[model samples]
Target chain A: MIKVRNMTVAYSGQPIFTNLSIAFEPGKITGIIGPNGAGKSTMIKGILGLIHKQSGDVTLHSKPVAKQLKNVAYVEQRAALDLTFPINVFDTVLTGTYPNLGLFKIPSEKDKSAARQALADVNLSEFSQRQIGELSGGQLQRVFVARAIVQEADVIILDEPFVGIDMKSEAEIMSILKRWQMAGKTIIVVHHDLNKVTKYFDDLVIINRGIVAAGKTADVFTKENITTAFSGDLSTILFSDKEPEHA
Target chain B: MRSIGLFIDGLMQYNFLQTALITSILVGIMSGIIGSFIILRGMSLMGDAISHAVLPGVAVAYMLGINILLGASLFGILAALLIGLVTLKSKLKNDTAIGIVFSAFFALGFILISLAESATNLHHILFGNVLAVSDNDLITTAIVLAIVLIFVVVFYKELLITSFDNTFAQAYGLKTQLMHYALMLVLTLVTVTALQTVGIILIVAMLITPAATAYLLTNRLSHMMIVAAIFSVVSSVIGLYMSYTFNWASGPAIVLTAAVFFSLAFLFSPKQGIIFKKKIN
Candidate 1:
């Protein structure tokens, strides 16, 4: 349901993507995968209005996406957060409710209950009182996921939520995404684990400055597209079976 | 040893001493609260820069024969805005931008002050003389404290989320930039108010050390703020005593008192102290 129309995005006056158009399918998990500096994060951030877009508009359900940010949940890369901040897990999760709360108002009891339920959902109830500084990398990622869960967004977009996390935490997060997908929420992820592409994404948008290919995982995540997106000659040797970090 | 008796009598008899005491307490609590946000965000350098950057504003206000608060706050915010602007518009890193802007503003302040040939003591503006604080200065400090208290109470959640993770705040359409600039505005107010107590040079110490000490002692922002406030107030009280009993400058006394607390916390704080580290292991 979210569509980026003829979007051109640049950072510091240098164009990364130009005149690129893509529409993500609703109720499906679409992974945006690419090589280093391939505009995966840039494209999503641009369309979501998180970063500047040189030209274009993004819409959700016939409304401008900017007007409906309340319905979209975006989880940035975990490494971007301040790990030493003085906040506990429960309060961090409670931030999700802030988007829905009106200005000059604090989260109500109902919102607090939602946060509690979210923490329970993510199996972080026991650690709700713990500071984020004490959390393991996997646990911290789960904390953000718990926050997103509490938001109850119609669309969830995450940037590298699985990277650097333990296998169990990765499985836990993917399962939640799967649940959201079943509930008809549009789930868009910036991911690069090629080995799990078939198992993870319902659709794939692979890019190298521009969309090299797009469509269903079975249809577009082929050898030819991989070669083009990863810059063929070197990718043939580098694209091994193991899912090495794509950063 | 010097004159506890005389200092106590002065506290009871002298209006100036009373005003100095009240202003120092207000400034202490104010700096403690604001400093928590600065240290937590890893913006200690920015804190240092903003404080020093207010110097030119004070100098300009003297030249214009206007209120120091008005001119100082205006220039403080301008310096903050320019730092942000240069960083975003160029490839230069944030520290480089801060280094360029604040030092330039400080150097300009020195030039302006010399050109203005003001009657006010240059040493006082740079190093603070709390004993000379007027009743009007006390009133200003109180007002700034009230503003800081109300701002923190009303926008607690907004500031917390933004300070901890700005990208998450931005994702949900919260105006992170507004929160940022708003804090900068408040920082300017605090720095301007602190001029009579901590002065420009040592304001960074007041804004950084107590909050940093609290950071090592607590894991909750609210608790950190409360502890920092207590630590700052205690420093001011003891520092005032030292200033009165001994012939020491008030600002350095207060800052040294804060530094001593930081040292103690660094050595003996139960949860996160170097001494406790060995014991726990």
Candidate 2:
């Protein structure tokens, strides 16, 4: 299991989560769902030590997760990427091997082969030399999936991996992730689509600043729980392909 | 063509011209190399601020009889950190921090220079005088260039990943904040060494124009670095030639040369050049 305990996270001095705790077990596709400002990404960042936390303990497989970072791979939201950066798709995917190589070690033939294999897995072998700016939204998201595959991390965390991509790409990425689930890797995904919650996630962590409900999707994905977490605002909006503007 | 022979003769005969030529060329190469990263990271403003912030440090160095490199780097780093702290701790934007800190240090520089004896020499810190560069200046520029080359060769991957995506870099346990500060420190050192080749104001141009020109010409960072370095060297060589022949100011001439290269790339680059871009009928 990957666990965060007593995590008190704040953004700009305003507390978002106070003494909150959550655990995501392996071999399950876990989804963390929340409203726009419910701190879904914030909570993930806090636990991973990406953002400062007032207090917390993050552990994976009975070891501190921060110390075992080589076992962790995270693909950020698509919007965080700099499309104009002077790098090709192949070099971008190859950065997944960086943590393992550390500073001063050149990427070897083994690493290059791994990156090439990953690009082929994502059906982007021909696009290896193409600049990232030239890619479609679906192709771009698949590129990141290819990067995570090369990372070969036991724990994978994705933040809104399906926000802008087409349905076909979404299914393609989910199948890759499901294969990881079968390999007993922990998968934590931040997803906001209401209709797909039961379909994509086996366990749900619904939050609005703090945990509203946590359990199997069938048990914790109730409309009452969602309305409470969404704070009675669920009735007005329909779950659709378009996502709310990120807060 | 005849003037080119005259410039070559000047280089072989006058020791001053030799020092200036060597220093200008090395500084040009260093600016291009580091400038690639600065423009890519979108820290061109930060580079400008650091180059300008060195003024107060230069002033203090002159007054205290200390090495200008040590003093200039101190204030340049201080300005960088202050800008970062303000942006992180408050709602103030990056540009605002740059404007406030840079202008304050620059004004202080002017006052201190006015009080110093033979401060006419210090005025060159604002507008470059390559002819005035000493052998020490040449050696300093060379050392700085070597340092930049080694830093890039060693940390190429770290810089690439961090500049491309901070979130991914951080998640993979890279000390992204450290990478940022380390880049800023190297930038400060580059700004300090740039004092003789290009002045504070035009150093920004040297740091930006060649890199921007190369950015237009190539989509790969490694290729961009080499192309930008070549453009920068050509600009400095041509600018120095103009300065020696027509008695134009060295810094402005070099800046203009870089600007001219950028214009050519903007018009005629193969892939991204504006001229061939298809417009909807």
Best by DockQ: 2
lDDT of each: 0.89, 0.88
All candidates' TM-scores? 0.94, 0.95
Chain A TM-scores of each predicted structure, in the order given, are 0.94, 0.93
- Candidate 1: which stretches are off by over 4 Å? A231-247, B1-5, B115-118
lDDT of 1 by residue, B30-79 (tens): 99999999988888999989888988888888887888878888988999
Model 2 DockQ reads 0.74
Error of 2 at A4 (Å): 1.2
lDDT of 1 by residue, A11-100 (tens): 777999999989987889999999999999898788778898889899999799998897999888888877778889999999999888
After aligning candidate 1 to the native by TM-score, how far in Å is the CA of A116 from where it should be?
0.7
Q: List the residue pairs that clash in candidate 2.
A: none
Compute the interface RMSD for each candidate structure.
1.0, 0.9
Writing each residue's lDDT as its tens digit, candidate 2 over A15-81 gives 9999999999999999999999999999989877898899989998888988888788998889977
RMSD in angstroms, candidate 1?
3.4
Cα TM-score of candidate 2: 0.95
